[model samples]
Target: MSSHEKHDVETSSGHDIAPATSTASNGLALKPTALERERAEQLARLPDPDAGKSPEERAEIDRKLMWKVDLWLIPWLSLLYLLSFLDRTNIGNARLAGMENDLHMFGTDYNLSLTIFFISYALFEPLTNTLLKRLTPRIFFTGIIVAWGIIMTLMGLCHNFAGLLAARFFLGIAEAGLFPGVNYYLSCWYKGSELGARSAIFFSAAALAGSFGGLLAAAISKMDKIGGVAGWQWIFIIEGLATVFVGLFCWWMVFDWPETARFLSEDDKIRLQRRIIQDRQGHAATDFDKKYIYEALKDWKTYGYMVIYMGCLCPLYAFSLFLPTIIAAIGYSGTTAQLLTVPPYAVAALATVTVGFIADRTRWRGYCNIAVVLVGIVGFSMLLGSGDPHVQYAGTFLGAFGIYPTISNSLSWASNNIEGSLKRAVAIGMIVGWGNLNGVVSSNIYISTQKPRYLTGHGVVLAYQVLFLLGGTIFMHFALKAENKKRLSGARDNMNDGLTDEQKLVRGDNRPDFIYTT
Candidate 1:
């Protein structure tokens, strides 16, 4: 027998099955890809712990392990994220508490402050996510949290626009890592199908932060004259100090990667790793590689997801930053406005988690995205078409519920479709980075001049929702479906016929066996 035939015989006998390669049309033997070789070695080194267990036994074990992971992992991450979001968006509440007047911020200084935060935020996200792999989640997360918390506290001391700008810029840099970093971090622990709900549970903290921030701001604003601090100053100082406390505590609470987690047993670690590997179709390398970064940059789908994220984030930031102001415009002011912001966000938090659960169970993230964006569109239209304050206030509830859920859905969709650690990290970072760059647009569009109806702001947000509906959710649904169909048809089976293993792994999501989640 020829060498190719001998290799095939070895594969059939399960001796060297890792490289699972096909012959060229010309009958030439193809070399096993690097990923295949690595996967084989990993499988040998860490055989599945559940391999000998019956299906019912494995199911029970998996259920228990998932609960353990959820109990240990999700709540801590959610708390960190909540504090991060509270620090970042509390500026909106501070504005209501007289930040603009106290700082003598002119026509666009307030907008500029918000815009500058996002500029640094957008620029640093990819960098921070890259560091997350190298530095480990514990160090990276805790360090950034401490840094941002300190900065947030100091923001309360800013006596001028320049001072506030500097604080916001640094705060942006410090807080930038948490959102995308957590997204990537969660991807490390959960399967694609499980990510939606997990991410939603994590992201619900933001909605909760909005709710809590409002109540906190309303309560804290009453401390306006205490210790010679303004209400806005108290808001920043109090919230910032609370964040610092959480950050210090996180040092003890945060776990590293699954294999290194202290809460899991040796068998649990093996089983968890095995399940994650199988979920990715066995692309399980965790080591950092330059090629993964390059591959992420080269993938068109990364940009596509970024566009979808843009649709979600633009309006998201706009609404979050301006919700208080919008409520004030709707015949409520000061504490009343702050308090009113609570219900919409509370409702949104509930809706976000609900949608996340549905997406996970249905495995239909794209469809869920469409459904939420439609709801947002209806809400935005009500705000635009009606002059009635009651109708407009009702719009906020719908807007919050609709927009908040899309992030988790779209993020899980992106995570589901992408394979590999570094590649997924970079892709998520870029998607979030580019998406958040729109905060500049979101900030400026809701100009003070466009108050009350703020037709331009409402119109722009509505347009973004439409784009999300048509260009993002609907387009990606069909596109991913077509890609999965092509893969199923086996047209791509020979695409890697002559490629090296490293090359095949670099192909990432384009690999023949990789099926996209639509």
Candidate 2:
């Protein structure tokens, strides 16, 4: 049986939309404001573009627009995430460069340092994303990114374990909200059908950054003997400075939403927004209150996704934090280990794009996530079970590739299953937030005790992967059973609304039949 079941999740609870007043069918929630209603009604009254251009011509234009937005947006967002990910994980590279010798961090203390970052990172996730939504991503995100970059750079000043721990804590605090915020921001621009591919593209930057960091560390570590600073210090100084500069570039370059992007004319903004409403079957977001979060939280799918993502992300971050260490154990010098780290990330970049393409072509994310895990099973098993160093390195590719889509599909799954603006926002934020707590487990997964072989860590990874597989399977099975409530409750009658895309903006995406996606 197919493990990823999607039902007609068509309503946003606590966001009551009287469908009788709705002018759209996108299953979005209705806003109470009279001005919003007037706008929807006015848009409904406009002449249809199909009234003039042929369907083929319209599609061509749409394609061009999507390409243009994707071409510019993917690189910029990817760059931002790339720097963030690199900064977060470069400590692994730092460790390989004899930083432990300089800082005297030999024990579980190193793991504690990594774990602290996630502690701060997990606590503030929803708060950060909420700020992004409330304040607009442009101003809010740039501030956080710059703060983290500066913190990451100052890490070079650390002389001992205590100093490193403080830097790591600040780094985590500064970086906490970015991933989830980017995920939420993407939801506004891309619809369900196209989001997974773009998500993969955004993540590919992170994948490439890992590879780039390794290469960079190899070159910079060689500089350690030259300067009074250690190799690890050079990694922090160069990479941290690079991140600050890139953050400024991203501030200038990133275009947040269709409504406000400078590149889009006023008409184009409206057109893009209208198109999105059309694609979603109505308005994607209608501002609702706190009751909305409570209602969305009631769904079992929310918790199920939380568990699966937790399992998946645990191993993902573990590997990200320890790849260079793992590579060094393969008997290479620090420089060679850095070079060796590139292949796994390179493979991950390929795997992400390939899996994303396949998922989109088939419109199948659930199984695609499953497939990714299978690769992890193979990869990590080799890393743990194989005695041969050459064979163990091959496992890195599998591990990284498998973990990449866990985020992609989980977020895509949220976008697909959840309906209405407030519910969608809360659900996505919570999922991303909860999933990150898995990073806590990951931060400590590969301890100094398990070093050399890392068998215990690999064993933990396999167990978590199995847990994820079972969770994904169960979520699909019963989620559909839950969706049946809408048909039974007579909610569909209240959900019959007539809203063209423009009509939906003012009249609202009033519907009640939606259940959370399984």
| Candidate maximizing lDDT | 1
> Where is model 2 poorest over a 10-residue stretch in terms of lDDT?
1-10
| 1-518: candidate 1 lDDT, tens digit per residue | 22111111100000112335657779897876555565555457676777778999999999999999999999999999889888889999999999999899889888999999999999998888768766778899989999898999999999999999999999989988999888877766776677788889999999999999999999999999899999999999988998888899877788777777799999998887766544445354335668878888998889889889999999999999999989988889888889999999998999999999998887787889988888899899999999899999999999998899998888888877776666777788899999889999998988887788889899999998897544777888898889878888987789888988667767767787666678
Expressed as tens digits, the lDDT of each residue in 440-461 for candidate 2 is 7787778777667988788888
**Regions of model 1 farther than 4 Å from truth:** 1-37, 47-52, 285-288
Model 1, backbone clash pairs (residues 3+ apart or across chains), number: 2
Evaluate candidate 2 by giving its C-alpha RMSD to the native, one decimal. Answer: 6.9
Error of 2 at 134 (Å): 2.7
lDDT of 2: 0.72
Please report, as a residue range, the 10-residue window in candidate 1 with the lowest summed lDDT: 6-15
The Cα local distance difference test for each model comes to: 0.82, 0.72
Candidate 1 Cα RMSD after full superposition onto the native fold (Å): 6.0
